[model samples]
Target chain A: MNREYKTGEIQAGKPVQQVPWLEWLAAGIGLFLVLGIFGVIGWQALNGATVPPVITVTVENVTPVEGGYRVLFRAQNTAGEAAAQVEVEGKVSTDSGEEVSQVVIDYVPGHSDRRGGLFFTRDPSSGTLAVRAIGFADP
Target chain B: MTSERYAIGLARAFGGAIIFGLPLLMTMEMWSLGFSMGRGRLLLLVGFTLAVLVGLSYFSGFEKTFSLKEDAMDAFAAFGVGVITSTLLLVALAVITFDMSWGDIIGRIALQSVPASVGAMLGRKQLGAEQDMQAEEERKQEAGYAGELFLMLAGALFLAFNMAPTEEMILIAFQMTPWHALALGVLSMLLLHVFVYSIGFSGQESRPEGGTFLSTFLRFTLAGYGIALLVSLYVLWSFGRTDGVAVAEIANMLVVLGFPASLGAATARLVV
Candidate 1:
């Protein structure tokens, strides 16, 4: 610490009591950041014991489109990898068998959701509707 | 040699990391890549990034250096600062956690370390320029072509660093038609050339008049675009965007990313 030379010997000999605002600020930020990081890690560890949820496809809404009925479905992924080209299938039980409708979803990132719609020329309100995740690939 | 100067440099470096490297730290794809990217690929990317940092240090570093050795040393030093900065921030954000494999933590930090390191380097130049009063005489002389090229790299790195980590690069490529991609490429080149011409850097005076048009467009514009493409490719690859993608799709993504990189390249001289 350099002291002013012009000052008297007593003053000059005194330790320079200068405040390093920037260094202190930096240290403060760094300490705050380190503490914040530990806090977050602790929070996450408490919250993340649960495994990534498997994607569950559920029919969200059924509405009438121009030509046919459009069934909106939501695909939720629990895993870390993206589910690409997700194919969601809708099967309506008929007296005869099962009438199926499938829609291709572009992608759904892990721990996220994507919406897609399936079109059916024939009204399926007359039967039981079931939707399932048929397949997916990495994007 | 004052501690104040060191503190200021460090403060500026932190600012640089936030300014230049923060977006990627928050990017979802980047976080995903930290886990998905193979170790070999990650290592290669780190090696290449270090090389570019050393090269940039020679041209426009946090502090000017007279020798390749100094530049190399500065590169590693900046890298150390960058890694520590990035790791701390990422952990603060909970981007790295104990649940993730050790590989995941290292990969994420190393990948983010590139732009953070560059930002650290730029912090010195951007914040400490006033201290360089003695170098004014040496700086006045036009930087050679290699210097210009490095400047372009810096600019491209600055701009591309923000966009490369996003999912938008692939999303945009997927959305574009062939015509759209072509138009983007043309526009990128045109803008790159026009931006440089508008700036009229002193470095331009070196071009002789006879074949000036051809030389300028070919030598600078096209070359800048090339560097941008390389940068885009590197960024995309480092982020794991290119893995398992079709060749055409990769090319499209490259062009999409190259647009900003070329703009960065074109405007390098003004920023530096």
Candidate 2:
């Protein structure tokens, strides 16, 4: 098959081959990504730990919404496992009474943060606002 | 090769990557799986993807290369296109932001690159000009029994990979009773056989020369279904869906994933 192809090539008088600069560039990019990703994953494998999710929630800010005040918070997972359906509860010690609000975050990956908002009828800033991650399900 | 021709091929690769990768890219579970999945499994997946790409290039690559070296190069080029396309789409979707750690960004892009690269490799057949496709069809006929099985495996893996990362595979498995699992398994095999052998789909493979119905059915459909089940199991394991599941539940999940996998295997010749 190679010989037949070569003879046919001769008969057709094939043009001089153009340099495959684009192909080389693409291959180079691919090579770089393959190596880079391998390196990152390898590094993680060597140094990473497998621990249960340790979630911490902190209040970011409070803003007024339609019917209530929105308390934006960030939930951070510091361990090596991901958590799903993370329930974060916010408690505010208001002068009238204590206002409690809760929000559920869908997922928080290990060593990552997810943002969510909790609604309260009263301004949380008027009192000490405390936000804590109540619990999480294994993802 | 002319630069214009190669350029056009590259363009088609990008198109294919986007078309194929978009579903996984938009999937929320895939994004989280990037960071949450085990590093070892991720590495294994990447390695398998490269091997599949090389095999695919041998059968029908973006370029018609006769040598293994050229095929490898084409595979890498497809991978490169896949990575670039995945990165751009991920960024545009805001799935990966600058604030995320390098590990997260790299993990997300690398995971997504698998489907994108496969799409890029398949793009030539799906999007190439009519004359080029005729040549590709002829080359496909040259692929023998082992090659046919390999294509089935590739197709199975493609569909399985897409579905494995989602939670619904496990959820659906949990919902199914044993009877449902058995019925689904039988239906998968039956449809796989019909699509590949009986139906007159484009690129359908005729029964083997001098082979009877039972022989063809035993050799191709049964083998392809087996490959699909295996591929489905492997993909589910890679996604960590089988880590703590019971053996019975795992079997159910296997049958559930095997449905799309069988379809993919059945349509490998028509699509890939």
Candidate 3:
């Protein structure tokens, strides 16, 4: 067996076993992607996303589902931690003072918008739908 | 690299990625973390994973020999293999697609890559046959108690990080009764001690100073499990999995996370 190469060990006119081209290619691409992930996440995190004390819920669309009408809503979390089992309540003004419906969202990651639905007996479109984040427990 | 040699390594890496990263690839919370994890935290995790990869390369990596530059390069290469394999699998499963934002695409692939990279680094060690019992003997001679402990810690971290971000960890804890939790705790400690004691992996330190069953258990096995729990708790916190829960709940979460972590610790010698 040939002896192992020492540090900077090479002979004149003998082509060093070409460091496998694939290794270099792999190394380069890996570093680039890792740094890219950091750059993308860091930039957005610093500039755009912030986890507020409370999630802000906005009703996006009111659609009819099987049992009742569903309120399609988005909750925006700007904070640093994910909130699970977030309770969102929707209140609509009808001829009766108000009709309230509540739904629990499974998970809302910080700094992202997650869509959920609130099933309501009354039509949300007919009346004004006011959605609010009632409470969230940390996962 | 020889064509045949490269083929073997690539195949091993592919298999390793699937074996290690498949569950995480399918997990929704993992997908969530991939996209929504704060940049600062994700960057730190990536950096930490890189450092650990380099260290693992020093002990047991895909490379045949230990060279700093080579190990560093191989670390990146291993990570590349991890990323590529993860991307392909997730895409095949439709977990990743063209319509998703760049953040989501990058997040899921990169997060899963962490475990995949470790598996890639460990491919030859775990998947391939042992070629050098001499090297194994040398490692056993040189890797004293502290070194063995480090390997266990690395193993714990690798396994704990895989599942800590998911909501299921806490959910499982909540589902378990106190008796079940205690039974699991006893099982964890027992398994940890048994694996390290009965199994003779390459770096199994025969005995630390003051060698005795009691001493070994107290010093290494018990301590190793402690590190596993601590690592579990830390990973949970870092992922914000433990953000607003009660202290008791946190303890449960740690134990739940610690189970796999302890298994990792017990098997560290085989992998690292």
Candidate 4:
């Protein structure tokens, strides 16, 4: 804390009067970030939608596991609101019977996608597979 | 020599940012809340945090400041350090990826920067040399009653911000009955008073000359607890914990969060 002050920079018991250029540079960067963040949020407030989450689930692939078949799917929320506890159901219509597999995604944010896997005892590739988001809870 | 001191201060600011910001930075709830939270509320929060940082700089900035302009500059500099630190950490952790929207990235960084900036502002007091701390102590004594309350508010906000983003706040509230809430509230206030007045921490304040126990309790302890509760509510609301929540549940949550907030308020002198 032993600051070296110039002749005119200090008065009796007062802090040094002159600020360094580096301080100003740091402050400028901060100001930019603050303003930029504010602007982005403000823009979103003006234009962001308030629609409920609309989730679309699509199966990515089906693979064989040791005991069963694994169906990987991606859940995409196209709406402006996020959803929690989203239920994605995959149904397979085979010559033998109809098999259903369900998986719950914890969260699917607006305009974002989440991947999950559903397990089925029967091979999903052997039947016509139908995958869709059944329901979602508001986040 | 001045430049060298400033450089050291800057490095300390970075260290402080990491130490204070790490908890919130690693929180999964905080990362999600950034994008899920209401944009208007998020904006208000960022604006409010900047104001708090400026006030903190006035009391104990990274450098000795003689004027409001100096304090404001330091506040902004602290914010810059916070934003940079948050951005770098988020990237390293894979929380901020190339595929994410710019909005999500900005939101995450903005929310995290609140605590990081406060840490940077307090870097001087926590990490500075001994003589620097003495100077800050002198500056703190110059503050009056209003200033003391403001410090309490800042302290409460800091602690509440740390816990409010977690799901446990609401979960604990839901688990508590009305009787439990009442007991916890009383216990929180009692602990807060003991920490500030009864116990003699290193930076503890002595009772003012001729100040009676009742007067001190009413003026500092009670008022500090009130501020703590208010700050807790604000933090909870900012994190969207109050959305669609029942009134009784909200009250319970307030009590739960108020416990830590009160401790933070009581320890303001030692910490802030």
Candidate 5:
């Protein structure tokens, strides 16, 4: 009968090397762990507890029209991206002799540039046009 | 038991150093000095040759045991591997950050790393040390490696906060000077070495617990200064004014400075 060579030694074929499958599996798991960690970190970093929307409303053009002022606005996004689900709102006002006239308009799911036109068709002799923006300020 | 194993180990250590160190040094020096790759390559070539000449001076007493030419070649291979590994990592980072398209990033990193790796390998091999001091040298090498890694982290951070143009973080991260980076890396390592010694030499057993704390406190305080020096320079240079510094940005900067110091501490703990 064949016998073993020595202590701390075994036949070339019989020697049980570290389980290849286990090693591979372990390595695979290790890799996944590393990737998962990085992915989670990156995700959390890019969009964490508070991530502001992409596009932001910034006043671009305000001009006086026949009846009311034609207001033009732009959405500035410096985060290297485009954003959706924008809402644009405008408020126009004029002060007459003793009375103040005001008009409010809202734009939902506004187009690109977060831009939508608003005509405050107020009586030219009544008051002035005042425009203010609402929705999405990246602070 | 045999000297051959030790020689191989030395070769690996030095080889690893060259494989890694060349690209690092070159990147930093060139960047700091405002030299591009083409000019930097020329400088690297000249500087590497000079370093080899200087490094070889140590073996003037015994030439038989060590071969400079052979070491240089081996160092080149190791350096190539190091550059490849680093470049790949850089490329992957760029891709993930959406800084570079897969095609552009891969092409650029691969192209730059290949030649840089070759230069690094050669530079490392050329830098030689005596065989008699192998054990001590190996310890030093390990310490140095830890130091370099920490320094790199610091340097990377410094670059990220200061030199990296916010509009082009990805590009600048890759394109920053290798030679300057390496110098800072070496400096960081040196600081770590001193820290290691300070901690190791300071006796704690005979003294009161507060005494040990005091010594550690002193050691760490000095270490803090060293980190602060780099961070301060970065802040002054980048922000133009240290006043009104953003807390988060400061944290990021400190993270960079702390990287190498921690590395040195960890290595010292492990080795000593």
Candidate 6:
């Protein structure tokens, strides 16, 4: 073990000693400890994390008025945060998949928080209404 | 690549993903899950991603005693195995949490994964065969140091964006604890390594003596079963938590945790 590099052994230099089992074991433990700490922290964070407010759309009662029915929708930020721009669309269809009518509304989210309405001439019993919302920051 | 190098590579890829991608996904998941965005959200997301990546890096290094020159094909095969295994584990999570009925979960996955699977298969073919073999040889020659780094970085980024549940996307779903994530990550890597070795040992060149195939199959199956059990436990534990947790969130995390290993394996297999 004490022999210096001889002639033949001089080709590649010196032999590398294998890591001891104790060193490996210690390293393993240290690694786990670090991981466990992060794990706990992340767990807590996920459990108590918050999210952004969403633009909400609600449809009011649908009653027959003349040929089409009247539908009312309200949009608001229930969280009271200022959303920039809001756009809502509605599609009315008959039970046979016939498109009765559609409408779109656009407004500033916080500044123009208001309710709007639309009228569609279609059979009430066989009609379905679908609404979608898209929001953005207004320039 | 050596096992040590592979592990290091996974660490870097995964770590990079968390740092860069986790926040965006988390934000999306949280918002989707109906949580209000606040100051702590960013910090929490960043912290969690870093933590998971660090854990993965450590685990990869821990497995360095094993050989790393195992071909990439073995890793891809292991990933295929993992997808099946993760599916079952996910089913168990759904059952335990009651977030989704088994029927519903299975049905949705069946519908959704078809496109994804088709895409992966086609993409795999286009990536080349002999090129992969040459690359594998080159990686081996380089001691897999660079390959590991590339993989770890790529994996981490992919997960941060595509895998971690976004705030807005967190719906009625399950959540995973870091313990579960760490365990599952390590367990998946181990199973993949075993599969790699089993494949090598089964080869005519690698094992000229050619022992019984049943013994190899049995050993691999048993190890796979053991890994499945551990993964199931992690999934079960994750689904048990529901405080603003969406079923998609846990599901997404599982993908993030498992994706890198699978990707690294698949990439190697495809290239080799």
DockQ of each: 0.04, 0.50, 0.32, 0.46, 0.02, 0.04
Give the per-residue lDDT digits (tens) of candidate 5, residues B186-224: 565555445544555431112223556556445443454
lDDT per residue, candidate 1, B133-187, as tens digits? Answer: 3342244243557667877887897788778877777899999999999999999
- TM-scores, in order shown? 0.64, 0.90, 0.76, 0.91, 0.26, 0.28
List model 4 lDDT by residue over B137-218, tens digit each.
6666767688789889998999989999998988888899899999999998898888887889977778878999999989
Strongest candidate by lDDT: 2
Model 3 lDDT per residue over A6-65, tens place? 222432233336456666676788788777767877765776554543589887888888
Clash count, one per candidate: 0, 0, 5, 0, 23, 46
Compute the interface RMSD for candidate 2. 2.6
Q: What are the per-residue Cα lDDT tens digits for candidate 5 across A13-92?
A: 52234223432332244234323333432342343212333455555676778875566665543332223334455554
The C-alpha stretches of model 2 lying farther than 4 A from their native spots are: A1-19, A62-70, A94-96, A122-127, B131-138
CAPRI classification of candidate 6: incorrect
lDDT of 5 at B138: 34
Collision count of model 2? 0
Model 4 chain B lowest lDDT segment of ten: B130-139
The order of the candidates by lDDT, greatest first, is 2, 4, 3, 1, 6, 5
Residue A113's lDDT within candidate 1 is 70
lDDT tens readout by residue for model 3, B5-66: 65576567667767877777788778767765666677777777887887677677665543
With candidate 6 superimposed using the best TM-score fit, by how many Å does residue B13's alpha carbon deviate from the native?
22
The residue pairs found clashing in candidate 4 are none
lDDT of 2 by residue, B1-272 (tens): 66678889889999999999999999998898888788889999999999999989877788766556667788888999999999999999999888776667888998999999999999887898743566566566666788899999999999888888887998999999999999999999999999998889988998889999899999999999999999999899888889988999999999999999999999988877
Q: In candidate 4, which residue ranges exceed 4 Å CA deviation? A: A1-17, A62-70, A121-126
Q: How high is the lDDT of residue B26 in model 6?
A: 29
> How would the docking of model 5 be graded?
incorrect
DockQ comparison, 1 vs 3, better candidate = 3
